[model samples]
Target: MLQMNDKKLYNDWAAKTSDSVMKRRPEINTKWEYEDGVVLQGMELVFNKTGDKKYLEYMMKSMDLFVDENGNIPKYSSNEFNIDHINNGKVLLALYEHTEDERYKKAADLLRSQLTNHPRTSEGAFWHKEIYPYQIWLDGLYMGSVFYARYIKEFGEEAEFEDVMKQFTLSYKHTRDEETGLLHHAWDEKREQPWCDKETGLSKHYWARSIGWYVMAIVDVLDYIPESYEGRDVLLNMLEETVEAMMNYQDKETGVWYQIVNQQERKGNYLESSGSAMMLYAIAKGVRKNYLSQDWFEKAEHIYKGIIDEFILTTKDGLVNVNKICQVAGLGGKDKRDGSFAYYISEPIVTNDHKGVGPFILASAEMEMLYEERK
Candidate 1:
């Protein structure tokens, strides 16, 4: 039941993601970075839905290259206090379930162990990373909490549920902007970071991708949260409110959101593919999981169509490319990123970046499944 465009774009991108790793892209191997985590996870989505052995084989081979016989993940130092590293741990659970290799379990355990000691704000939110002390980036919520929630569920560590939910609840409480109903990119508990608003302690504007990360985190984490858990309501409600806010800003003509979400009319602001893809995935998955209204079905369709019609271009060789992807976006990195509206729009836009391609694949998988269900 996959749409024609879904089959074309996702199939092309799936091959591209695996081919990139098979070639050992510099950023991809053994490193615990979430950017690669998402791509691997997206490959799993395709494998799960289509029963494609190659997709799963590619994912497993990539992990096997990095995770060793003793379940040790090379180049991953637990001392970094980086929640980004937690994202790859998501692949471990599925690998263990499929192969029942205790090494996968032990590998997952190592990642779960990091959450035990990861630093947190006074309000109990995790700092995005060690270097980003006292700040909670929306990016970290997806990177950390989805793995944390899944591990606790899979391992029967029910006691950790409350702590896991607190991260989501507190993030919404701290970062939400009532006027826009959009959460800021990150929140600085100390309000001392160069990007913070002295009075509000929140980043200056809503970057589409950051909000995309927050929404994707909850939708993914919700897969493991018990329906009876009251905290599930909190996460669902946040998803609803935030998506409602974001839909108001959707480009009326294109159905995609701007890089700086609130500045839709700004001269430099352009519609971004990765964030649009993430938003589509979140909405489609939310509706599929019954976490959001059925009305979101139409919204998801529009966004998906927008990405296909606006972002994807077919190459001369028939390979499809996803364009307008933000090459990178972060704060307080090596060069010192100033989290500003201008800073966001200035990032390079490229074709078929993992950030865009992975989410596009996941979103397509969700939409395909939804279409099958409705049929």
Candidate 2:
């Protein structure tokens, strides 16, 4: 198989997504959401890499629709504490640093304000959302802590640093399953939710994307956590253990992960692209940051090649598709997610999904740099 050019693939994906959504540009989905944030963060990384103002323009355009001249995000309510909403906060510091606009800072501060009083477990972790009370989802760590760590880094909130680090520490302590070394999807302290295991307070099975979210969370959040911090190495070691555990479950043939990661033999289990891409990003970035070793980079190289062959494909119609992405999954909402292995594999698979594409873009951005340096 021909080698995939990381830069070209990422650029093409972004252009295709931008064109598809052009009809709604100035009026883009201004929800301040995870999906939009994921894609735009990819765009932001690309912009950072290429120094092309176009990517910046795209991000600002969408943000402008929601942010007034004064920088109040209209629909955002910190009161509810939905971690999904915090995903967009990742891009704010980049915008503020480049533009030095008070609005960006104000907007970021608005998001950060939520952390101060956000509801938490008695042990001091933010609830995934208000509605999902007394619960912590692996997904929530990426969505919330990455921004929290970054805000502390930017604005010099030294006192809050320990709290930010503690969240990751506590999450690691609670969710990790020693037998498999894979953390479960979510944990309910009360264990009242239908999905949580009554004894362990952990969710039923290891959902790959939650692990993916978590791996990415630790790496990205580490960028803001000072290396000298007393607890940093503890988290770093935990990160290594988690990544190694996850790699052990990778399908030997497909090089991708399963929707229900641990049980490869289970019926309806299948290779999933988005989580695969996310793992690729986390591994590549972690290696790049020296949190992991040279061997891990080699491992990332192998996984990236696997992702290309398994998930990156050009359709007969000429659209390049990132295939096999699990569409959506959650626990205990209007339509209750039972958190079963079946519930995981049953989520509709999609192609070129923004969630998949976003991290793929970031992974590619890192790999592309590695590629260029090798040349």
Candidate 3:
């Protein structure tokens, strides 16, 4: 599989860390940046694997930078209820489990508080943003649902499970294409957005990373969703359908998914890292949970190997590099993102990017666990 030496690769990946958690800020300090959560998620796995407490301490200290002794997060507003903001809840949950810290619990509760007041459509789908009215994005599902499911499980909030189910079902109902079984990037309920189709609630075309987010969310949330819940089977079926649909678009040569999943022939549409890692995680976990056949696991293993060989770079400094990460994807906005093949390819690709690195670390952790189980 990964020809690069394992010890050397580990050393390289570990070298990327900074000495103090408080010192880790984005090189280009932009709001809504992806760096902290990405590093924390990756570090969580690394710590679990190696039992190195420094990584865990780094995560706790970094989170402490945002959270105060009183358990309130600094510079965070719950009124916005943007699902992207909830991603860090995973770290909180981990901290609570490991350290039994009340501060982490309070910080997670703050995120849960947003769910009570967050705007939702009549069908129970969360709006992607307050400013972007009546829109449900594929990206939002992974962002919020994983945290929601974990919260519900941790606190015995069984009643909220229905809301979780409704979120996925409504999003799929609006965005799923009947013919291709692929989902659009976002759906505008008002159909007022220029990117939205008049007849269907769908955005332009199937975006690979968007679908990847949904796939990863479904599989992850299923872990905590009670097996007896009526809607649980529905989610499993959705995951199965999504897995089948995704397999059709995977490049046979590279064993990785493309930027625009269905449009491989179009110029500049290359294989992407985040989506590939997400798909690998979903498929491997699906098979582990017995929701999918063993055949899918073989495919996931193949793709995982492909990612290591093609996308990952081992720098001289011994840090792992995730190359060819699409910076961002979106629908209607001030900028024109038509969701065309060319538009998808036009996004800048960066090395050692956090977007891809977090998911890659997660996928690798799962694969390593599976290998251990088999052994």
Q: Per-candidate TM vs. native?
A: 0.93, 0.92, 0.90
* Residue-by-residue lDDT tens digits, candidate 2, 1-375: 235565543344444444343333445574666877887787787788778787788788777776779989888888887878888887777788878888888998888888887899999999999999999899999898998888889886677888988889888889999898999889999989999888888899888888999988888888888877777887788889998999899987766788888888888898888888889888878777788886776677677777878887755555556788888999988889999887887788998667787777777777666555555
Candidate 2 all-Cα RMSD: 2.7
Top lDDT: which candidate number? 1
- Screening candidate 3 with a backbone cut-off below 3 angstroms (N, C-alpha, C), the clashing residue pairs are 12-318, 12-319
List model 1 lDDT by residue over 60-155, tens digit each: 776787788999987788889989888889888888877898988998988988998999999899999899999999988999999999988988
List the candidate 2 regions with Cα displacement exceeding 4 Å: 1-28, 315-319
lDDT of each: 0.83, 0.80, 0.78
Model 3 segments more than 4 A misplaced: 1-35
| Candidate 2 worst ten-residue window by lDDT | 17-26
Span of ten consecutive residues with least summed lDDT in model 1: 1-10
- For model 2, the local distance difference test gives 0.80
Task: Report the Cα lDDT for residue 268, model 3.
Answer: 78
**For model 1, what is the alpha-carbon lDDT of residue 311?**
93
User: How far does residue 339 in candidate 3 sit from its true spot (Å)?
Assistant: 2.8
Clash count per candidate: 0, 0, 2
Stronger candidate by lDDT (1 vs 2): 1
